[model samples]
Target chain A: MEEVVIQADKLTKKFGDFTAVDAITFQVRKGEIFGFLGANGAGKTTAMRMLCGLSVPTSGEAKVAGFDIYKETESIKKNIGYMSQKFSLYEDLTVVENIRFFGGIYGLTNEQIKNKTQQLIERLGLTSVQKQLVVDLPLGWKQKLSFSIAIIHQPKIVFLDEPTGGVDPLTRRQFWELIYEAAHNGITVFVTTHYMDEAEYCDRLSIMVDGRIKALDTPKNLKAEFEVESMDEVFYKLARQATRAE
Target chain B: MKAVIAENISKQYNGKPAVEKVSFEVDEGEIFGLIGPDGAGKTSIFRILTTLLLPDGGSAQVHHWDVVKDWRAIRNAVGYMPGKFSLYQDLTVEENLHFFATVFNTSIQENYHLIEEIYVQLEPFKNRRAGKLSGGMKQKLALCCALIHKPKVLFLDEPTTGVDPVSRREFWEMLKKLKQQNISIVVSTPYMDEASMCDRIASIQSGSILSIDTPQYLVKNYGNQLFKVKANDRYRLLEVLKSVPSTKSYAFGEYAHISVEKGHQMEASEIRQHLHQNGLTGVEIGDAEVTIEDCFINLLH
Candidate 1:
């Protein structure tokens, strides 16, 4: 059996009178591409923040990368990478400068940062514009570069929150190729997205609604369980069922 | 006569052509869509048509008034909802509506009939600040403001991109009702499924138009025999299907959709049998219909 890279039992989070994530339980296997799906304000961001150790859970037990999230948050931080929905990068910095800055923050040697930056720039076909400011780059290139910078530290798991929110379909397809490569290299990827079609690309996924996981399984299994022909229909069935249950 | 016209409209940013040599028209009372992703010139086109920005090379006319020569007349005769939430967040829901109407030298009461259906939803929250409303509600208020002026033509840029599915459906229903009022509507969206809701769409990519047609016509012209196949081990099944000499395959839904080469004479049963022969079990295969996303993917390839 594959080893579990992330494990949570009765994990919960709350802000004031509202519960953002409620007693969620699941396991993410090593090297798995796990999709985290939810509508706006459905607790996906909160759940991901807890997993990445950016926020402490209100109550529950969880482990990430073989370390307890509550007691070993610093370790968790060291071993995991995170990219938010906005592609948080310095827009005024050049492409190469952005990579160097991220690499520096991660405490890489100057030579190491330079070498990796070169390799990544070449791989992404951004060699020509490495010196150009990020704000001047197109949206697609910025997304790809942000993703590469996130994993530059060689973290065990990378948390991506809606990494391709506004990109074109063609660029999104290429972004998934990079993710597939990361997973193949034994890096676990936890990604959140609203796009149902992109959900089909994951090895497995969990759908959240109103601070709870409404469905969890492979895309194929979820579609079969819902008896829907596409993920969009599956999402609609689940979301409507969730609303009705409430 | 066309309700809207653009003659070689183009815009440049620091010597780079953001909108290059693009021109299109919208007939009166027609629903036209500008389909593309972020930075695909959809917003640029909308801004030029709405008279918010002057194009470098072309002239545009809305409701028989030149976009440049008669800017105020064009603004008064058309409604525009920009991609971003540009409403006054500090104002109450009712205040936003009244302010917009007042800007057009009209009152909310004067145009109550024009916005009755949409305004009714905001009635309960008339006292709430615009910032406090949810994304869907905020969208409705923006639509209400844009229509309060009673414009003959409407321009919406990516209005439903981030909205929830239910809200998106509601918004489109509102658009349909507005279209029935004989308002020529031009909207842009990144969602391909929404293309079917429009009378016609221009599929755009990298600042260029790929195709312009009705959603049904686009699918009808897809020209592929698509099949959905599944088995016990899906990953292995995908690999096996890809290796098939006469098959071009990709994962779609719970199955791998494969397009067989012509003259191969392979039936679904034969494909299933072949899967069984390859040490796979419980293989199921059947013909499948194409979708807008599929058409877009095919076009991209």
Candidate 2:
């Protein structure tokens, strides 16, 4: 049986009177790629922040990697990896240096960092440019490197926020392969993306509309439920139900 | 007649090619899209025609005037919404709109007809500061300000980036209306699906134009026999499919888009047999409809 790696029950967050994230409930299983879908300003970020322990929820509960979101944020932070829309690599550092720096931040031992760095560099075919500063790399290379570093510590779950924005189709394709590999290794991937095609790649998807879970199902089932041929249409059907900020 | 024209327009920054020798033309009342991934030189092309940046070589013309010599005239006749939000954040929406209108020696009342549709959506938030508006509202206000002077041409650079799907739909609808008003529109975007909404498109890469045609034309000649293939183990299926002879495979959404070699017939059985021979089963293969994105990736190869 697959363990529930992440669970949320009536989770809510309100900024002043505006409910940025209303009561929401969902669960992510181990080794699942769970897609958290929403339009910009749809409270997707607010909900993700609450789960990642970056922000406190005004009400309800969530458990990430067996850690309570409110009382065990420090433990939660240690067991889950995170990557945002913005590339978080240090531009001034070389590829190898950047990896070491991130590994160090995750409290990895020098020996573990060295072994993992070599394997990662070889797997990504970055040996030729591993000594080059990250800024000198192409946008695609930088993006791939960022994802690898995010999971350097092999966290049980990884939260990726728009990880493939502004990249070419080939590069985006390659990045998802990395994600599939991670999920194969029993890591839960919780991701949010504006790109609907990326949403289609997930194992299961939950769409938030005006801070509410409007739809939740597998991509195929969601399309069937909405009677659409594509995830884009499914998203369009659900997102338009918003009563605010249309 | 061409509303805008470019002949080998190029620009370099610090000895690196930002926009290599490139050329395209937009016809009057036609919507032209410059489609590519980031750093594909779409912005540089737009800036040159909008008179924001000068070309290092070749030339461009807007409103039948040279870009370099008639920069001021080009600026006056062309409306540009940059890739990023460029409005005054501290000011209210009404103030920003008025400021833009007055900059062109006009008023909102003078050209109210030009942007009435878009402005009405933003009217309720007139008193709210521009920074306080949502992503969709901010873009709408920007479009309103850009259209305040009734420019003959419009250049929108990635205006839908970061916008939600619903707002993106609404924004494109607004653009379609503008095109009907006989205003030539040139938009640059990384969203390949959006390229289909344009009347014609130029697929660009590495500072060069790969293919330029109406979206339908590009898809019709996608350069190979394409098939949509899927299996139970999709990730493994992708790797195994790559090993098949006479094929170029790419991940398109949940399925693998395989472009079989020319004259290969690319029957579903042949592909299924190939995967089955590799101990792979439960394979699904069907002839795929090519999109502008497929054409763009084909050009990349």
Best by TM-score: 2
Model 1 agreement with the true structure over A59-175: per-residue lDDT tens digits: 999999999888899999889988886767999999999999999998899999989998999999998999999998988889899999999999999999888866666677678
lDDT of 1 by residue, B1-301 (tens): 6888877788898987788777778888999998877787889888988889998997889888898889988888999999889999999999999999999999999989978988887898899999977666888899999999888999998887666665677688888988899999999877776778999888776666777888889888777777888887655676677667776776665567777655565678777877887899878889978877677766665
For model 2, the DockQ equals 0.62
> What value of lDDT does candidate 2 attain over all alpha carbons?
0.89
lDDT of 2 by residue, B1-301 (tens): 6899999999998999978889888899999998887888888898889888889999999879899999989888889999889999999999999999999989999999988988887888899999988778999999999999999999999898877777888899989988889999999876787888999998788899877899888887776888998888877887888898888898888788998777776677888898998877678889888987787777776
User: Chain A: TM-score in each candidate?
Assistant: 0.96, 0.98
Whole-model Cα lDDT of every candidate shown, in order: 0.84, 0.89
Weakest lDDT window of 10 consecutive positions for candidate 2 chain B? B260-269
The candidate scoring highest on DockQ is 2
